[model samples]
Target: MRKRRTAYLSGLLALTVLSGCGSSGHSSKPSASPTAAVSWKFTTLDLGIPDKVLKAPVTGKVPDDKTLHVGVTLKVSDEAWKKFGHGKSPAQRAGDVGKDLGITDAQLQKVQAYLNQAHIQAKTSKTRTSVTFDVKAGQAAKLLRTSFVTHKLNGRTYFTPDPNHPPQIPEQIKPYILAVTGLESYSVAPKARALGASAPGRALPTRAGRCIQRFPQKFASSQRVAAAYGFNQLWGQGWRGENMTVNLVEMDGYDRNDVANYVACTGAHIQLGNVNLGATEPAVGAEATLDIQMLAGLAPNLRIVDYQEDPELLNSGNGADSWAALNNALQRIIDDNADKKRPGSIVSISMGGPEGFLSQPIMQAIDQSLRILTATEQMSVFISSGDCGAFADRQYGSLDVSFPASSPYAVSVGGTRLDLAPNGARTGEVVWSDRSSLSRCENQWGSGGGVSKVFQRPSYQQAPGADNRYAASGGRQVPDISAAAINLPIYFRGNWVSSGGTSAAAPIWAAGMALVNQGLLARAHIFCYGPDTFYHALSAGAANRPYTDVVAGNNLYYPATAGFDLSTGLGSPNLPAFFNTLAANPG
Candidate 1:
């Protein structure tokens, strides 16, 4: 096992190095120092295309022509940073830089002038230090080529890097650029293969559907456990999350048809709203489809708001911009909800990069946003703990954790592999494994959990498994909850498909929360429950609930346990009974 772990870690490191090599060229020098003369990055969206044009590509059709988007990374000199009084704090410094850039009202005017002079129509812009402008589809390439030409704005020559002499981005910013652009793994296309016979057949079961199938049976059993625990029961009749709205953040966009089909399969009447943060370009894979479908499946009645950040804006490779996009989305949701006075809003994010690879400033920004959303909106955010385990790389034997989920304010959802009887009853469940093995029985990708090095235990996590001693001893509890994320067959685009990951678990938990919210409303409660209360309620009924304690599983790097192990968290949901309990308690 030790040898295998070393190999896995080595492989993960190699993968990261290779991934870096494939994209922008690697550099040892810091990309852009806050003190650099031309230090700043900006993102713009391509939006002149009609809605019809946007939807066509999503339907698997090619566009009449190619559309290019240029996300520019800029840097200000150190002297400029001092003149602008950009502070040491990431948020403050970024804010200061944004004020210098077009992120402020004054700057916005200058930016608007520039766009007007260029005959460009700027759609919407996000206000992180990096300001993003949405432009026309085909126009971006031209803008990229010419916009960098020194242009006069606000009586000063706002030096735009000549397209012929584009500004160089520091090596560190590359990964972030890859993440925001949704192009990190763009070099790899979907490897198409036929579905195996053992895979779930077409037409799966819905919570309300009558045609019971094996998959439904298993789901039903899980639901029944929640119901038995009085947790999964329906709340007020006619309450379809009318009072609540949810925001789902993901790296790519999904197949809308597949999402609609999944909803039909589940007999859910949920309405999904798509908000394109990125340009109208479709993400290259299934990440979007799976995330949206799972979220809808779990929370059938809530208003599902989907926000897609401009992939090009992210391609600038600045981690701060990614956080800015996330913050922008959250702020947008908050503003929208406030305008409508909708309480109990929630945001579910299923995407994350490795912890060590991210910059401290960016991490701080993320942490601050999480705290703000949790406090002001009373919004419960869910993040996938990770598909990797404690020793993230079993091949190389390194103990590392995934991020965003590690952020104290967000609830981390873990994964589990489930075994079902012929009748759809769950026979057992274990950690989803994704470790490479010679036997090749199952790939060992399991739940990501454990302690944090950077984050101290928050007050809410002061339960049996959470404490200073444990955290000090490198034992922070992860994945406050669990869901079936291993090899589950879900209906997508009128077909049943099998998929699994911490990605699946995050949305599943979010859907469960939607149901709980319904129950809370039924009982005349208005206050949103905190993570502590939710977990306490879950812990109270763990034994009597329909949970199948995963005793015999491993993430390839670590062994699974009977209860409350990091490998599977608190175990998969007893969906039905859990809802019932929420309805009864209404807290």
Candidate 2:
């Protein structure tokens, strides 16, 4: 009906399955009937928070006076999800994504009425899908059917909800909702650190053509990136990521001077724009600096919209997570127009933490939100598969997977150790398995990957070459792919620093996806957004030259093999062949 982009879909897509990488002592499922409009009197669906989050110990001392700000999510209805699958025009698709179609005015009024009944005031978002409101420790305990106490994590004190029983959803808004997140409020960041003895980067290298970039510095730049990735052939064919826009969410602001200086230093032709999402502190962090530099460095001609989020919301000394900011950013990207509109080619999120530590409701909420992007909006979202190789577990030796990255719809990117010849030519690459070898910090070596103790194996993942050995576990795996994560220099905090992690790897896939979308924005509604052709191409690369299967190294526990393994996933994409395969896409 919609130009049949669905042809690229390989197998049955478990579009409704909601799970994460977190492990549960036992399985739990939230009850929601799609067809039932049950009574409003005692109609409350009890969705319990995961035990792992409740059981996680805190670190900081609780203050005498502390308030709880619970984040609430209203699920998107099934009708809105059908828009992407059924709609034809961009406007038709954006009609809902541009705004929160999850909750109606009537539903909002009901929620507000409930809030008033509880004597609690809520801060509703512009989309009306997310709300942030304050509640006393006792008030929250009664509202969500959970017990609350102050706990410290990472030296910060905040409220952690211990659900003696599952959370309740009012029957009045039952069938219309998907997930209501924000039971816990802890967000993690990119797992990267400085490479010791960072020096001034090398000068720019000479370029043969006008379209290709020129990198002079010893630090990797946009030009050398093209050469190293075997994109030379495509650049000659006029495929330099023009007419594309990549949406990146770093939850932190970046230095304007640093970005401009990187462009000037590298002679890149890229442009960077920012959509401020209520951030008060405009000061930039090193992570933001490196993220922007890497995107512009790879796809120099591509437009990047850095969706800057509220710093207070991002790192609210009270263990605030990225859910609110990410939701706001994604909604803006979907609804954007006039000067702020982007092409919606791909999204890159280079941050994450242990999936199990994240609450189940939050994971489901994010999963449904991503369903809007991948299944509905037809946009590709590439999330970095964390830097920690498995999670810190001394008891059962469990390898924890990262959240958001482990979401079924996301193309999870791992890390790799890249080696270049003296002349800056590619030599060899391996899985970025560094266990205490790269930093004094723990869990710094290899890329973040492992089995999803939460999510089941989606239908698309059930196909061949998706690690057949793990069928017994019947869960999702961490990284679907990987790219360069080591031996590269990035400009951060006024100095050039060498850094690598899964954070560095995600942008590679995202920028590459932008190039795949170049000259095809108007047809974005027909593009394959999920793990369709790209996964096929990656799988083909293994037997062919387009993919380099890393048969060595491990992510703490799982080993890299000739095929799909948790360490390097399908191994790094071979640029020439990978692009060739993507360009040949009929969509």
Candidate 3:
């Protein structure tokens, strides 16, 4: 018989506390014995006060403003846990905790009273399991500070490198902290798991080949735009983004067979390079596969470089390590471009995390990398605006924007939904659902868009519609351009998968950039600005250009209007006419 493991609440709590107290590691609760089972529950709160107050005020100046927004986590005791669980997994146990906690009553009242006694006004309270309430700014700080001075709240401990400031974590409760906050860092076991349970066999190239035929029709509007820009005619003269190199940054790795199928279907000869950034296992994962497939289908001749970074190293939630990987990849691209003396190279990043979650150092690193690309005079970076709407799903709501995309120095791509006639002609078009808005997720498809709380409006964005008054003070305008994202069909595996996200939009734009790079190279103008400059030149070229303004459809948050709006940006690019104007003005 197998040896039975003894379980005690104290021992289990100790293990859990040790595991979760640190910023890293998998979240696990104490295992229950056969006599009594242990489980965890998750919840969220509103914390009615503004984030600026709960957090240290900006600029090291403590504001006299006495407001605080505090969200608290309360662990359910063993008895409560048992009562909540009729015998189910932790995921299933979640549903019961909401009711037992009187999540609608008692917990909420407790939160309100705490704030009221602290002289903090309670704006609102949303109680799930963990309750969030807003109070006067600095109230949280006051409570934390006073707790220390009075030598009370001994069970509460804060963690950080600095003595003066650190985030407080209530003692002996791992489940509550994990549920309410983001993870700092983590490491997975050495053994790799198969990508998924169902591994389908590779099939012949029918779907891939069909994608080639369907491409022109599916993107007829974009093709029309390209024709208006003179891309089709330019390609007629043998300039089709043939020799340029494009790199895609993504999590997980791609399927090798799928990539080959896509290449075969598109009739495009592309080189693929996979760089594992210290992943213990293979780099082929879901995200990687999607990016490679889309990029290859769009620009067949462009060399594809896959840079893989360990998910654990960057903190399991896809934060810091992503920035590190991006910087390192850019450096590698720059070095390679110099080695080959290639005139132009474009980097495409489809993966990103919510802003404000990143440390200042990471943001600086991004700025430095962009400066390098700009200074080298031969490189441009393209980043996805994010699939989550402007606020990144409210949980991280703090006037924050998605980074690298929000960085003023880089070209940020938004999304649009396309409608095609039976023959693939443009029947209709609208702002992609992925555009940043509160309703994005509700629609099941949305692109991340919103004003940036961190970056300021750049000179280019100071156009007629670029007024800052429309946004919260200190916020930056976003989504310089838009492309088809909603319900876009791609050849995945043996069948076609209709997927819509900013993930689809970024590569589509990246492919367009690749075509532009080829055109620039052919015209002997290797070091040029991004598509924005190209579009501006095209807009000035001729009134009768092939470009069509998207005036219908909304991102469900913002409407798509005549010219430029946050929804569709400057509308999808007219590739043909765009190329023509570039040839005309080889600046």
C-alpha TM-score for every candidate: 0.60, 0.77, 0.61
TM-score winner among the candidates? 2
In model 3, what lDDT does residue 538 have? 41
Clashes of 1: 74
Candidate 2 deviant stretches above 4 angstroms: 1-47, 50-67, 78-80, 86-105, 116-147, 151-169, 185-221, 311-317, 320-322, 335-344, 392-397, 437-443, 462-464, 519-526, 538-546
RMSD of each: 15.1, 9.0, 20.9
Writing each residue's lDDT as its tens digit, candidate 1 over 202-259 gives: 3444444432344544443323333322233442244434445667765565565666
lDDT of every predicted structure (CA atoms): 0.48, 0.59, 0.48
Candidate 1 vs candidate 2: the lDDT winner is 2
RMSD of 1: 15.1
Q: Show where candidate 3 strays beyond 4 Å.
A: 1-159, 165-233, 312-318, 338-340, 393-400, 434-444, 462-464, 468-475, 525-527, 531-535, 542-547
Give one digit per residue, the lDDT tens place, for model 3 in 1-587.
Answer: 00001111110011010000111111222232231221323222222222332343222333335322232334433444343212121222233323443234443444444334455442221113333334333555553332111111223221111123443432313333212221111111111111111234422123334454444345433344344334456557665556666776655655666666656655556677766644645444545665665666566566777766565544433233345455555544433343244445677776555565554444554554454344332355777776655554334334335677787766777776677766765667766653344432332335556777667766555433445345546555567676666544444544545454566667777777677667655565433444345345545557535345667765445566665555555666676665566556534
Compared with the true structure, what per-residue lDDT tens digits does model 2 show for residues 258-284? 676666665566656666766555556
In angstroms, the error of model 3 at 291 is 2.4
